[model samples]
Target: MSAPHGINPNIPHSARVYDYWLGGKDNFEADRRVAEQTMAAVPGIRESARNNRAFLGRAVRHLSRLGVRQFLDLGTGIPSQGNTHEVAQAEAPESRVVYVDNDPIVMAHARALLTSTPEGRTAYLEADVREPRTILEHPDTLATLDFTQPIALVMVAILMHISDADDPEGLVKAYAQALPAGSYLVLSHLTLDLIDKRTADDYVAATSSQAMHRTPRTGERISRYFDGFDLLEPGLVAVSKWRETPLFPDEPAWMYAGVGRKR
Candidate 1:
C-alpha cells in the first residue's frame, strides 16, 4: 500500500516539526507552519528542543562513561546530527544501538544515515513505541543486543506524543521489565508547569492535525515512569536543568528529563 498522507510531504508530522525545531531541513512547509505555531504558543520551544537534544548527548556520554555498551532508543525521529548511536559510539566505539520508530520516512533516512563503526553496530526498526514487545523481540535487535547485559533505553522527547489513553506509565514498565537490572531509562517529556493552561491547551490543539498528544505532567507524575528504578542525581528536573553546564544553564522550559538505573 502507498504510504499515508501524514507520511507524505504535504502532511505535517510531529517528528518533522521536531526536526525543524532542531534546525534541520528534512521538514516540509506544513511541518514548518505548525512548528512556528507551536513556537508562538511556547516561546522557549526551540530552546527546549535544543536543550533536549543536548540532554540526550549528556546522558549518553554519562552512560558510556559508566560502561553501558548497548542502547535501545525508541521514537527515533528523522536522522539528525549527534544521534544516539553517533554519540554513544563516539564515546565507546564498541557500543551497539538499536533505534525504533514508526515513521517510514524516519526509517528510510535512519537506514541511510545511521551508520556505525565496524567494532560496533547500529540497526533501525520501523516499529511503534506502543508495541514495545515487537521491538524488543525483533530479530535484528535480538542479534545486536544481549538482554542480559546493561542497555540504555533512550526515550527523549517522544513520550509527549503518547496520549494518556495509551498508558505511558505501563509502556515504560513493560520496557523496563524486558531489560536487565543494570539497564538505564533516559527520557524527556513535555509539561505545562511553566506555561499557562490556555497556552498549553492551544499548543496541544494546534498539533491536533497530526493526532499529537501533549500532557502537561507534574514532576511526580513524570517520576512514575521510573517507579522501580533508582533515579540519578538531580532527579526529574526540567530538560534545561538536568546536568546544566555554563554553556547551558538551568532555564525554564516546558520539558523535563531524567535518567534512572534499574535496581
Candidate 2:
C-alpha cells in the first residue's frame, strides 16, 4: 500500500510491523519484510502481538467497568480492531480517549478510524513518548482529558522502543507524577526471556535497522515501571495470562503485562 504523504514507505516502522502482525493492511513492503524477519527469529512473535492486543482489551474493559472515563494512550500503534477507544467506549460510551504516537502514518490512520461515540471524544497527538511534556501539555490532550479525574495511562507494547539511556522507568514516573490518586497505569513490554540469544539478537538487529529499538527487559525491570502504584489482582504476568485464560498455557510468555492504580 502507498504510504500517506510525508511518510517514507521505504523504512519499516515498529507500529506498521505490529499492524502487519495483527493481520492489518496498513503496512508497507519494508514493514512486512522486517516483520517476517522477526517472525523467523521467533515463530511465536505473531501470537505475542495477538496476546498483547487481547491484554489491552481486557485491561481497558476492566478499567471502564471501574468508571475510568479518560484514557491517555502512549505509543498507540497503527489503529486496529479492539483499540483503546473501542474497548473503553464499548463499556462506557462517555469515554474520552487521547491517542499518542510518533509515527505519522499511525496518527493518520487513527484520525481516520479511531472515532469515539457521540457521548465521548477521541483526539490524536503525533508525539513521541519520550516527550512526556509534549503529550501531557498538548492542547488536544488538555481539552480531552481532565487531570483531576482518573485517567488510564496505557503503554502497551511500546516501552521497548525506549533505550536505557532514556531512563524508561523515570519516564514512566514523570507521567505518573502528573496523575492524581486513583489513576491507573496499564503497561505491557517485550521480553527476551523465552527466546534464544541468537533469535533475540536477530530480531533486534532487523528491527533496529529501522530505528526500532526492541529492548527486552526482565520481569523485575518491567515491574519497576509500576512503582508507586498498587498492582491489581494477578500482578504482572504474561500478556496472555493477565486475567485471561491463555489459549496456549504451556508456551512461554514473550511480553509482561500489568495494571496498577495510583496510591
Candidate 3:
C-alpha cells in the first residue's frame, strides 16, 4: 500500500497505535493489530490510555491556571479532543501552543484539524525529539513563545519509545537546559514496574516495528529524568492521580506522570 502524507500505511506507528487505544479511528490494520496484541497481554490498556489523555488535559489546565501561557508539546500524537491548545486556551484566551511530532501522519492531520482561538496561537513543527536543539531553534516556536517567560514542555506517554542507546536522559536534560527558570517539564512514561518481566518483554516484542520500539523504564528512573526540576506535590505518581479526580479509582495506568519546575 502507498503511504499517505509520506507515512507508510503498512507500518504500525506508535502514535497510530496510541490513537487506536484511545478509541480513535486514525489507524490502520497494522496499528490495530499491535494495539490489540498488547491489550490481550495487558487488560484495561485502552482505559489506561484514556486515563493518560485525561491527565494531559488536567496538567495543561493546571499549568495554564498558574499563568504559564506558552506550551511546547513534543510527541503530540494524533490531534484528539481536549488537545493541549484547547485545554490551555480555554483557561486563557491568549495562550500560545506549539505542537511537535516526528510522524508525518500526525502533522498532516494536525495541519488540517488543530486550530487555536483568535486571541491565541497554535503551530505545528515536524521534528524528532532527539534533536532538542532543532525544536528550540525553530523559528515558529521562538515566534510563538517568549523565552523570557515560562513555558511548559509536554511529553506525554512518548519518551518511553526512546531507546537507551539514544541517551534519553541526556536528551531531556538538553531540553531542560534550554528553557529558562520557572519553565516546567510535564511528562508521562510507560513503566515495567507493575507488570512481570515476561509480560514486559512480550509487550515490547509484540510491537515489532523499529519506529514503534519501546523501552519501559522504572518509576525511579523516570523520576530521575526530572533531575533539573523540583517536583510539585504528589510527584511522579500514576497518571490518573496527577492533579485530577480519578475517573477509574482502582485501575492503575501503569504510567508515571510529573510536572516539575526548572530549577
Best model number under TM-score? 2
> For model 2, where is the 10-residue window of minimal lDDT?
244-253
User: Once all C-alphas are superposed, what RMSD does model 1 give against the true structure?
Assistant: 2.7
Candidate 2 lDDT (Cα, whole model)? 0.89
Model 3 alpha-carbon miss at residue 240, Å: 1.2
CA RMSD of each candidate after superposition: 2.7, 1.8, 2.0
lDDT of 1 by residue, 150-193 (tens): 99999998888888999999999999999999999999888877
User: Taking the tens digit of each residue's C-alpha lDDT, what string does model 3 give over 81-143?
Assistant: 899999999999999999999998899889999888999999999999999999999999888
**What TM-score does model 1 achieve against the real structure?**
0.92
**Candidate 2, pairs of clashing residues:** none
Q: After superposition, how far is residue 124 of candidate 3 from its true place, in Å?
A: 0.5
Poorest 10 consecutive residues by lDDT, candidate 3: 244-253
Candidates in order have lDDT scores of: 0.85, 0.89, 0.86
Work out the TM-score per prediction: 0.92, 0.94, 0.94
Residue pair clashes in candidate 1: none
Candidates sorted on lDDT, descending:
2, 3, 1
Query: What's the count of clashing pairs in each model shown?
Result: 0, 0, 0
lDDT, model 1: 0.85
